[model samples]
Target chain A: MNLRRTTTATALLAAALASVAAPGWSDTLRLQGYYDYVDLQLGLQLPTVVVPGEPTPFGLFAENAGPGTADYPVLLLSGGNNMQIEGVSGCTSLELPQRTCALAPLVANWAHVLRFRFHLEPFSRGIVVFGAALTSEAVDTNPGNELQVVSIPIVAEAETRVAFVDVVPETLVDGRLAWTVRVDNDGPSAAISPFVYNASWAYGGLVDVQCTSNGTASCPDQMNYLGPGSGWNIRLVAPPLSVDNPEIQVGYGVQPQEASNAFDNDGVWLVYRDAFFRDGFE
Target chain B: MAAVEGLMRGPRGLASFARAFGAACGGPLPALAAMLILQCHATTAPWSFVVMVVLALPAWWRDDGARLSLVDASALAIALAFAVSGLGPGWRFDGANAVPVAGFVALVLLARHARQGDAARVVALLAVVALLQLVPALVAYTRTGDPSLALRDAAVPWLVVPNDLAWMACAWPWWIALARERAGATRIAIVALLALQLVAFVLFGSRIAIAAAAVGTGYALLRDARGRWIGAGALGLAAAATFALGKGVASLEARMELWRAAWSLFVANPVFGLGAHGFVAGYREWMPAIPVDPRVTPWPHSLPLELLAQWGVVGFVAVALALVASWRSARGRRGRYALAPVAIAFALVACVEASAMRLWVWMFAALLLAWPRLDEGQEGTEAP
Candidate 1:
C-alpha cells in the first residue's frame, strides 16, 4: 500500500513537473480582450454580439509570465470594424496604425496573471493582436512571448440560446406519469426548428409516446419562437412503469436556427417519481 | 424489476451490478465535487457525475445496513417540500435536489465499506486531483497565449477553472486544522496545497471566493467566540468589498432590486416558492430593477434566498435541520469538528453565488456528514 502511494505521488510530481517544464514557450504572455474575459458557468463566448456605432473601446491586457523582463507593447487591428485602444500604457498610435508606438516597456512586467478593464469601442468584426511582441521592439530572447491574434467571431448569439425552461413529470392517481415541458429562446434571434424530447427514453419505439405543441398533439413540427417565452410547450403521457429519474432534453436545431454553444442545444432535467411519502425511493 | 427478474435468474443477481456501479462512482465523486466547487463547467460536471450516482441507486436500495440517516431523512423532507410546492402554481417539481441528496447517500454508504486507511487515502486522492487541475490550464496557457485557457479548453476533457481551484481552496480550513496530524511529506503537501490555493485566489480575482476562504481560515485558526467574531467581521468585509467590486452604482442598485424581488417573491409565496427553477421568470417579471426582456438567471444568486424562493419554508426548515444535525454530529464526534468551518464557508459562498442545486456543494456537505472525526484511529468510518 505504501508503495502504491509512493508510486502515485511520483506520477503526480512528474505530471506537475512536465506541465511547468516548457516555461519559455512562445505563448508565454496572455493577450486578453473584452470578450476573451467573459466567463460564464453554463455559457460560451461567441463574437456575434458586437454592436456597431457605439464607441465601445474594447479591453486589451498583455500579461507577462516569463522569467525575465519583457518590453514593448503593440495593438494591431484587422477586420472591417474600426477599433481604438484607450488608456493603454504602450498604445501610442491613438487607435490608428497596425502597430502602435511603444511606451516605456511596462517593465514587460506581469505576475503570471492580470484582469482586463472594459472600455468603449466602435464596433467592428476583425482581429486584435497581443503578446511579448507588443511588449518591445527588440527581439525577445524568449521566443515564447510571440505576437498572438484573436477574433470575436461575428455571430448573432442573440438568436442562438434556446433551453428547456422546465420538464416537470408528475405521477397520476392511475399510476401513469404526466409530463409537461416548456422551451425558452432567451436569446436575440428567433429559433427555427426547436426540438424537445425525453432523451432517456431513447428507445422511443418501446414506449407509447403521446406529445403535443400548444396543446395540439402531433404537430408535424415542434413550435418555434422569435423571442423569450415564445417557444413551444409540450405535454407528454409516458408509458406505464417507466424508470424513475429519467433525463429530459430540449434543443433547437431546425433551419434558420442554430444552438448557442452546446448549452442552447441541450438542457436536461431529472424526473423524479411521486416522492412525497415515506420511503420515497423514486 | 424487469432487470432484476432477468438478473435474478442468474446467481449473483442485482448485488453484483450494485457493487460494480458503486465502485465506478465512488472514486470520482469527491474529485468531481472538487471540480464543481471551483470551475464554470460546474453544471455539466455535476450532471454527468449524477448520472453515475443515479445508476447506482439499485445498489443503495439493496445494500443492507444502508438505511436513511438524519441527513437522508432531512434531505427527503426538503424534497417532499418541493413535492408539496409543486402542487402549487409557481413551484416546480423538477426534483433537482434529488441528484445531490441521493449522490451523497451513495457516497456515505461507499465510505462505510472503506478500509481503515481509506479516509486518509481519499483525502490524498482528492488533493492530487485538485493539484492536477493546474496542468490543463498551465499547458493551455503555454500553448495558446491565453491565461483564461482554463475556462475555454480548461474543462474540455475533465468536463470542467482557477475559480475551481479557489473552490477547492474552500477545504483548506479542514486541512489547516488537521495539517499537524502528519509529518514530512504529508505536511509539506498540505502546506503546498494551501499556498497554491492562496495564490490561485489572488490571481483569480474572485473576491467572493477569497472572502469565503478567509472565513474558513479564520474559523480554523480561532475555533471559538473570537473565530465567530472574525467570521462575522469577514462577512461584513466581504459584503463591503463585493459591493465595491460592483461595476458601478447600477450593479449595487440592481442587487438591491434583485434582493427586493427575491424578498417579494418569498413574501408572496412564503409557504412554497415560485418553484425550484422559478427565479428566471420571477426575476424578469417581478424584478422592477431591470429593463425589460425577462430571461433566465437559474437561481436567486443567494443560496438561502434561493431556497426560500424555490422550496419555501419547508426547504428552509429541512435544510436548517440537516445543518443543525450535521453540526451536532461534528461536535459530538471527534474528528468531524474540523468540517464545521468549511461548511460555514460553503454557506457564505451561497450568499454571493447560487449553488443550492450544485452537486459539488451538496457532495461535500453530505461527505462531511459521513466524515470520520479522526482518521488516525477510528472504530469505523460510519457517522455516529
Candidate 2:
C-alpha cells in the first residue's frame, strides 16, 4: 500500500514539475487570422449550508480550456469574514489579508484544485460567501468562466447541556424519591425557542413537579427561550409503595427552532427509583 | 479557393455521395447536438462533444474557411477567458472543466456551419428541440396530475430545471415572428407551440423567466409602430401581475443584497478582480448579515455583475466587445428586428440569474455570430 501511495505521489510531482517547466506551446494548427486561445474555467464545490462551530470542507477548481497554456496563473482567496479558515493547503500568502495560491503554467485541458476547510464562528449566523478567482498573465478567452464563488449559509446555533442531580432521601423508610433535572444553555447564541420536557412515573403518579426558581411552584410543560449561559432547574417528587417498585423518568427535548446546533440532548432522560423503599427493608 | 473548387468537382463517386450526405445532415446537426446536451445526465456533456465534432466534419472537408471577423475574434477571446479561469493550484480535471471548453468549441463549429448553410433551418431545429422538452412534462403530468410538478420537478430528473425551461420559453415568440409568412396550417402549429411555451413560462413560476418573457414579447410588440401602446400596457400588466402573485418586495430585497455583495467584490479588485471563487468569501466579510436564497448564493444572480466581480473590467470588456461586434455583424439581415425581444429578455433574465454559463446561452450566441448577411439572400421562410 505504501509503495502504491509513493508511486502515485512521485507521478504527481513529476507531472507538476513538467507543467512548471513547459507551460504552453504556440498552436501549429491555427486558422488564418486566429491568435492562440487560452480559455480557463473556474469552479467551486462546497456544501450550501453549514452549522456554526463545525469545520466545513470546500474545493476550488480551475481548468485550462486551451489551444495554449495559461501563463502565471494565480488563485486569489477572498471573503469569509465570519469564518476561521484553516487547512488552506497548497497556497502561499502573497499579500497581507489576501492569500494567493500561485500555480505553475497550466497547459491545455489541465485543471488545478485547491482543497481547504473553514470553521464558522461559534455564534455566527446568516450566509457566508467564499470566493476564489483565477488570474493569469495572458488574456483569457472567456472571463465569465474564470471566477468561482460559493455561498455557505451558516445557521444561528447554540448548545444545551442537561444535568441530572440525585439527592439522598431524608430516611430510607420515608418511601420518598426526589431528583433535580437542570438544563443550561451552554451556547454561542441564545436559544430563541422553547424547550419542552415531560415527567412520567412508571408505577407511581408524579406527586409534585416544582420549578426551583419559583420556590416550589408548578413547572410549565415547556421552558421559554434561554439566553446564552442561562439555565433552569426542575425538581420532581414521587412516593414508592412497598408492593410497587416505582420509577420516575424526566424526559426533555429541544426543537430545532431553539437555535440548537446539534440534537445531542434531544429526547433524552434520567430514571430514578429506590430499591430499599420498594422492598420495605430499611 | 481553386483547390477546394477542384476537389469538389473531382469527387464524382462515393466521396461525392458522402459529401452530399454530410451536407444534407449538416443543417439539423447542431440541433441534434443541442438535444444531446440537454438530455445528457452527466455534466461532462461527452455525447454532445462527439456530435459537435461530427457536425463540423463537413465544414472541415470543404476547406472553405470563413473569415475570422472582429465579432468572431471577440467571441474567441471570451472563450479563452473562460478557459484560463480554470487554471488554479493542483493538477486535476472534471466534468465542470471539460464541458465548458467543449461548449465553446461547439459554438465555434456551429457558427461556422451556420455561415455556410441555412441558418434559419438550424434555428427551426432548435425550436424543435425546445418543443421536445414538453414530452417529459407530459409524462410527468400523466403520472402526478399536477401541472406545476410536471413543469418544475418532473423534468429535472430527465432534463432541465424550471428556470432553464423558462429560459427556453423565451425563444418561442421570436421563432413565431420569424415564421410569420408561412402556410396557414404551419402558422397554426407555430401558434400552438407559442401557447405551450407561454404555459410553461407561467406554470414553472421562475420569476426571472416570466419577467424575461414579458420584456421579450413586449419588445417585439413595441417595435411594430402600431402596437407601441400595447407594449406599454403589457409591461404595466406584467408588473401588476408580479406584485399580485410573487412573494413581493422581500424577494427583490434578497437579490439587492446579493448584487451589493457582488459589487463589493468587483470594487475590491477593479482590474483583474478576484477569480470566480472570490464572491462567497467576500460576501461573508462584506455583507455578512444579508439573507439570500441558498440556491442563488455565491452567484451575484446578475450575469453582468458576476462578470465584473469575478473577472473585473477585463472580463466585462471582452463580453461587451463580443456583443457589439455581433450586433454590427447581424445588421441589415432580413428580420433582424426579430432578435431584439429575444436579446432584451435574455439580458433581463440574466440580470437575476447566473445563466451566462449555460450551454443554451452559448448556442444562442453561436447562432447570432452565424446569423446570415442580407446580401447572401438566404432568409428562411419555413414555419416552426
Looking at model 1, residue A114 earns an lDDT score of 21
How badly does each model clash, as a count of residue pairs?
33, 47
Candidate 2 docking DockQ? 0.02
* Residues A63-128 of candidate 2: C-alpha lDDT, one tens digit per residue: 886645666677877766666565465454344355566766788789877787777665566677
TM-score of chain A of 1: 0.32
Query: What does candidate 2's lDDT look like per residue over B179-219, in tens digits?
Result: 66466876787777766766665555556666776787677
Q: Which stretches of model 1 miss by more than 4 angstroms?
A: A1-282, B1-63, B82-85, B88-98, B108-118, B137-152, B156-166, B224-254, B290-296, B372-384
- For A1-282, candidate 1 gives per-residue lDDT tens digits of 343233223323332232234322112211111111111111111233443223233444555443234444443333332443344443444444343433333433352222222222322223332222333332212212234454453233333332343445565787555555544455443344444454434222232334455556764254443343355454455544534323322222322334442224444444443323335554
CA lDDT, every prediction?
A: 0.47, 0.56
- Candidate 1: tens digits of C-alpha lDDT, residues B1-384: 444454665666676655555554444334334433333332233334334334433433334552445654554465466566664456443333344444444444444333344455556655665566655555555576544454455542221223334456567665654455578888998888877755555554456567777777676656555456765665566567545555355534555566667777888788777766565446545676443323224445577887787777877887798777666555545442356666677777667553454544555665665564223244322223
Q: For each candidate, report its DockQ versus the true two-chain complex.
A: 0.01, 0.02
- TM for every model, in the order presented, reads 0.45, 0.52
